[model samples]
Target: MFEGVDLEVPAGGLLVAHGPAGCGRTSLLLALAGRMRLSGGAIRVGGYVLPAAGRRVRATVAVARAAPAVALEGRLRVKEVMAERRLTGAGVTERRIREAFETVGIAPRGSDLVEDLGPLQALLLATALALAERPGALVVDDVDEGLPPDAHGSVWQALDRVRNSGPGPTVLAGCVRTPPPASGLVALSLPRRSLDRLPAETAAAREDTAT
Candidate 1:
């Protein structure tokens, strides 16, 4: 559990929730996406208040790579995954699927199995699926997970492209490692898990000072 965490990212910008393992970054992202409930405090996404308007917030936010709710099955083919999502009412079009692959700089054959994809490729696929929904905001967790230090740059770059893609939805990502500086990048670091119960205002103040 965490509290007093606050942030405001402009449309089309990227916000990285930076922290170490078990620091609640993933939970934070999940809550922001309206997939998890908040025990206290408040969240306002676009013009909608969370919990009170959670259904609308869930409809407005697309979450990828957060697990349980949004995960790509390795046994599925790329095309099969796209087809399933469309059938489930993600509203992703054939044209948008192709554009999402291009947006993330991948060219996977529709026949390729998700299990055969490289780390960055898998991430791109998850991201592509989320983008296909065309939500007002997109949340992705573990931006640098499983990627080598050298390849971290590539992952961030792809996300940057996603941020700039058509309509440019606000992008929020969770990362164990802080990202290098980039245009429109906002890094918000969380305190240690031991401080999880710290007063809300104090946490917000710490965030401001650290950033």
Candidate 2:
């Protein structure tokens, strides 16, 4: 439950929603992706109004949730996921999917079951699926989950590259800690609100570096 939470993710830019637990970081991401409903507050995605135009917003936004909570249906295959993305997404080609898979570094045979991969690989697979959509906007929750500290840099670097790519998707990613130093990455820190005061309100401090 959060109120007075405002955010601005520039077109084709990267915004890192960084905060500790219980700070409504997950909620914010869910709300933006139209996965969660809000009681009040106007939200517009890619110029379309929210809740009313939620379907359009959803079409434009792709989400990759935390690995533990977001399971691939038992024995689901990698190629099948990419195939689904191609069917649902615009201008998606098999080569594009392969490129995304390569970028994520998960090259297990497409015949392999989702259960076969390790946690990190599964996360990467999910991420690759999202990237395959080439959506107008993408939201990835718990970007640093189940990843090594050193690998965290690679994740941020990848996201930054995605954001800076030519007319690529605008990205909003959630992380419990800071990401690697990079320009054009806006880090929005959700301030911890005391339960006694403003128990239902949430606020974010901008660490904008949009140059």
- Candidate 2 lDDT over 1-211, as tens digits, reads 4455555556777778888887777777776776667676657676666667778677777786643444456467876877777886677788877877777666868887777776577767777777777777777878887787777877776676666555567787888897666666677787766322222332222112121
- Which stretch of 10 consecutive residues in model 1 shows the poorest summed lDDT? 202-211
Per residue, candidate 1 scores C-alpha lDDT tens digits across 20-86 of: 8878787877777878876766677777766688897788788878865678999999989889878
Model 2: lowest-lDDT 10 consecutive positions: 202-211
CA lDDT scores, all candidates in order:
0.76, 0.68
> How many pairs of residues collide in each model?
0, 0
* Residue 17's lDDT in candidate 1: 88
What C-alpha RMSD separates each model from the true structure? 5.0, 4.9
Off by over 4 Å in 2: 66-71, 88-91, 191-211
